[model samples]
Target: MANKAVKVGLLGLGTVGGGVARLLMEKRAELSAYLGVDLQLARAVDLEPARAEELGLAPGVFSSDSWSILEDGDIDIVVETVGGLEPARAMVLTALNKGKGVVTANKALLASHGVEIFQTARQQGVGIAFEASVGGGIPLVRSLRDSLAANRVTSCLGILNGTCNFILSRMTAEGAPFDQVLAQAQEKGYAEADPTFDVEGTDTAHKLAIVASLVTGAQPRLDDIPTEGITKITPLDIQFAGEFGFKIKLLAVLNNQGGKVEARVHPALVPHDHLLASVEGPFNALHVNGDWVGQVLLYGQGAGRRPTASAVVGDVLELARDVAAGVPGRVPPLGTQASGGRRLDLAPLDDARCQYYCRFAALDQPGVLASVARELGSFNISIEKVTQKGRQEAGPVPIVMLTHEAREADLRGALKKIDALPEIVEPTVVIRMA
Candidate 1:
């Protein structure tokens, strides 16, 4: 039976480490039966071997030094759940060079040094399983990389970050503000010590870049993806969006326009009826549009102990099986080379047009509306409807303008000029119409 036991070396015993212990203990027989290989935690690598044992390490199998396992001739697979770039990067690189298959859930590591790691693995003739990198335990990365490999992906978009989504959902549901909801989320451990990555959209951007690379085989630079956060999204804005039959969502959108791809993240006005809008709570969802599969929505836990650990273990099993079968060099969800890939600006937004919702508060004065409309017309932007609200409880009078389809640059330019107007009471709230 090819010794139904696959000896695995594990790295890091954090929250996910404990979860991996539970999963390996519980699902060992099932996994072994499935692959005809007993997955054993042959060696565990952690800073403090005692702490790793605290998580219930099997007897006689422990290592304070991860290098021992990396160099251990008996180990068949290396499962790295360690989150970071430096040591994780060096560790994965070393293991791959040693011709050991690696399985990891480090999105940051994968996002930054994926091409280098993937190419090295290819050269070493080993599989690198990272199914949990994008959608936590959802297996989306593997699906995109293997199952949908043949399909020509048209658009990849989603609410990929849980922290930001939770805050935004609270702002919409309870009519609460951003900072307040954010504080609560932090208190609840939904946010990080430095929530900048999650709130500022960089986290989602990282996932999008990885997904884009997988779909396009071209690793796009992080800075190339134009990103906007949800910090500016107000409760009133969310309310108005709902009233107008739209739901607000922070979406990381990737589109393949001809030979190029455009990746961007921003607070968007998605129709309530659309599946993305229905996604609520501290959950993550991805929408992949393919020529063959059409459109598929994958929704699940974006992070945390068991979910992330399950993904890591799943990757571990895949690597174990692939290595045993002597079929290594499995490509990642994204086909990334160390240095050959180049990112091309897709300029896809220009191709996809939409109506815009603008809120401009001007003083109670005549010719103000006409002047604002005229300024928008300069860029060939047309206003479909103009609604002048009576008066705000505080501040300037409110003037909401709904504009017809126009390019984003034109809309932005028109808003900038309107902001400079003397008649305008305050800065406008402009959101893309659903």
Candidate 2:
């Protein structure tokens, strides 16, 4: 008897879609042998069919309209790699309604509409696999959903966005400014022209929200999470951080305190010897700490055509195997029970407790440090170490302070009072030390 053929329909032919198509064809024999099922590409949909041709796809396999795939009877799996929220959202929902197992690499859509998407899949008794959404080919989602399923995830700290990481890495290494390195990242194709989403920490926050929802089973409100960008970081700050045994990296943080989850994104001063601190350039690393599993670190190329394609195709194979075994919805879309009804409180940023690296550009006159210290002491924000850089004579002197563990609220209050002082020349730079 001939092998059972699991037909797949691809809904996008962009970078990741092209890579998935190539991988499916190139690894057909290996995948078929491993899954004990033959995978076949029935149709590929893209606004530009020329991308399919550019990838050397067969003439009959590519189409300009997605309706053909959505309307097809033979497509058992629909892979959607379209990045945005629009047509991609409509296509994924429609495919699920049609009883087709869907695989997607749309993080933005999933972050914003995951509850709706998962609910639809559950109601329709179909499967949706999104391993490619969070960490590209790093397998972080599978680890959280399957491998670490037994443990109570305590916290997840990661460098989730490559563009920000690359820019920060360049700035730290060369002691260059943010604009220079950002321009370099854009020229090298690591950053987008606008780069606002990635640079402003929105991208990292989106990934953090997804990871938090999956691990805690409590879908969080994305807007409530406090977010900060890396644009304020300067080479002088980087130099000061190094002198204090810390490196600044854009971090996505999700921590479960008691039962409430804290989700935030910002530039943090990581100790130089920390594992996440070494993750440089346009790479991503996630450090997940669980009660039973202890610390687990996953690192890899976070994005790019083939890297992301590896994850997209992995989801396809899993879906194919599940369909062939007649267990289409064996695992839930989030690999857990539906959490749409669960309300996870996002801990306010002011409640956080951590050490801080505070830099103040103040007048060289005496009592400047005394005034700042007095205000900090008023809030019980005791300093662990304080250093004043050599005077430049013409400009405000730089005073860097590393504080012991202090409540974020106290630190902010003290900084606000100090900033109002006439002696303070520039806005203080307050970076949390992890």
Candidate 3:
């Protein structure tokens, strides 16, 4: 008997796809030795075959038609880096139905349709690997699913989006406004021309959903998670946070209390000495708290051709090893139970309890501070400390307060009444303290 070759096929020739192809070829001999099989790049599918030439791949190895890979019986694994929702989903599902393993970095597609996709893999008796879907090159997903498998994950907090982190870091460093920092991020290519997805917290929310599923066995509804962007963050808030020994970063947090889960994405005031606060620039860091393992922090480049591709290829090797072992679906898609029977209730953001940082632009009237305090008391929200400077400014004075731990609903109601006061000149800025 001879050792059969494990054939691989790629569905996209973009940055990540190119990197995967390059790494696969470069490390072919070592990977083959480790897996105990001849690993081959059977073929690659791309809309523009000319792009394949740039990667220095032979003509026969790259094809414009996707069917050549998806329908090929010899291709044991299908890697879908084409991204987007449509063709990626269709290709992955097709490959699984044909008894081929799948590896993907399409976070949007999985976050949206993961339940159905994972169930399909189970039905087909094949495994689906999505290591690159969250945290880029960092092995957060695998660690949570495998290494920390013994302990129960209590809470997950992360600066998941690098673009927003970079923008916020710049604002904190240079005392720049949101608009100015965003423009600088675009110039540096850290952010896209239209960075709404990354800046608005949608990208972080998607990654959180995937993380929540692995932490718990339930596939959460993406639309149900409360999300808030960093667009409203200003240098004033940054300065105030620094004064309070804190830094502001957009955070994707998931808490599993008993069986109830609370998932949200928003800008939070992290203590200056906290590990997450120290994670600056375009780098990402995820903090997971488990019963036995305690707190674990994984930090690295969150995205780019090389980092993302590294994760994608890591998944490929994992699935390849599974195929060789003859235990393809041994590990569940959600990393625990094959049947997602656990249905955890989603916690409403209004019910969450946390400290708050409040700022008000007031008319500097003697009773203005008293009025704000009284309004907050009306909602049963207590202030921990209040800072008001009596400078001889022409306009309204800035009144900043740090409130004790209070219900989110109560803070919202208090802010509504406070903003309605005649002395308040502009909208109140309220950031949650982590």
Candidate 4:
């Protein structure tokens, strides 16, 4: 089996698919040594005929329909990179039904329909490996689900989306606005042409959902996990957070508090020395808190053509090794679940108790401070520090306050009273001092 070549069928020969094909064509011997089996790209599928020919793929092997690739008699494994729910999901189901192993990078599909897909594969006794779906090519999914299987993951923190991380990191680094940095990321191919999914933080939410399911032994439904984006992070707020010894990073946080799992994605403040605070640029970092390992940080490039393709091929080799060595059930079903595990509720946007950093424009009245403090004190939220800055010509002087651990709802309630005060010229800008 060490010298045996395994045939592979690929769906979608786009950027990532091209890289997978390139590896099979050029790096077969290199991969063979690692997996103990030669890998062959037996067939490739694409929607465009000219595009397939443009890449100089074999004449007899190209198919516009991906199902034809899955049904290929000679192919043992199917690699899905077409993305989206429609044909990609249908194609993967067909391959699994046919007892052919599968590898995919579709986070949305996996997050939404993974329970059914994994159940089907588990019943059929075939593998569905998806290491590339989460952290680009970092292999965090396998690291948590396989390497750290012995330990219980107490919580998982991630800055998952490269685009969101890049934009936020840039806004903090260059002091450029989100829109400006986003335009630059789009130009650099770090952001998509549409960029909605990446910037809105739903992309991180989807990835986190998958991570939660893989780590918790339960399929995490997307609706159960809440997500927040970085669009509202202002440079002023960034500066304010910096004064308090923190760096803002878009974080996907999943925690097991008591027994309930809470998943969220948002801009969070981490102390400069925290491992995740240093994950700058377009790179991703996952800080997994295991009961035994305590904490492990996985960081690297989270997206790319070759990097993503490298993950897909790694899945191919993993499946090939299992088939060649008759290793049964060593690889768990992709995002598999246990019967007792349930989808945990998403922590409300304003439920958790976190230190608050808020700034407001207030009239420099002597009694104004007392009025503001009373409002927050009603909710049992106390101010730790208050700094009144120079007056502004347009309104009251700016008052910056750092609060002790306070509920988000309490802060929201107090802000309502403060906003209505004549002393307060404008609304408050608040962020969690994570």
**lDDT value, candidate 4, whole model:** 0.81
lDDT (10s digit) by residue, model 4, range 1-434 = 36566788988878888788787778867877777777777788887777677767765777777778766766888999899999778999899888888989999998888878887778777888888999988988889877898888888889899998888888888888888998999999899899889887889989998888777777777877767788888887787777778888888888775556677777788889899998888999899988898889998889898888888888888888887776633466744445223444556656677788778877777877888888889889898888776765756676778899988788899899889988888888776665
Candidate 1 TM-score to native: 0.92
Report the C-alpha lDDT of model 3 over 1-434, residue by residue, as the tens digit. Answer: 12878899998988899999988988989889888988888899888866788888865799899988988889989999998899788898899899999999989998888887888888888989898899899988899889998989999889999999999999999999999999999999899998999999999999998898898877788898899999999998899889889999999988876747889999999998888999999999999899989999999989989999899988888888888888887788887764453444588999998899999999867899999999899988898988887656588899999999999999999999999999998999989887
What global local distance difference test value does model 1 have? 0.80
- TM-score for each predicted model, relative to the true structure: 0.92, 0.97, 0.97, 0.93
Model 4 TM-score? 0.93
Worst-scoring 10-residue span by lDDT in model 4: 334-343
**Alpha-carbon RMSD, candidate 3:** 1.5
The best-first sequence of candidates by lDDT reads: 2, 3, 4, 1
lDDT (CA) for every model shown? Answer: 0.80, 0.89, 0.89, 0.81
To one decimal, what is the Cα RMSD in angstroms of model 2 from the true structure? 1.3
Better of 1 and 2 by lDDT: 2
* Cα lDDT, model 2, residue 20: 93
What is the number of backbone collisions in each predicted candidate, taken in the order shown?
A: 5, 0, 0, 0
Ten-residue segment with the worst summed lDDT in candidate 1?
Answer: 332-341
Backbone clashes in model 3, listed as residue pairs:
none
- Where does candidate 2 have its weakest 10-residue lDDT segment? 335-344
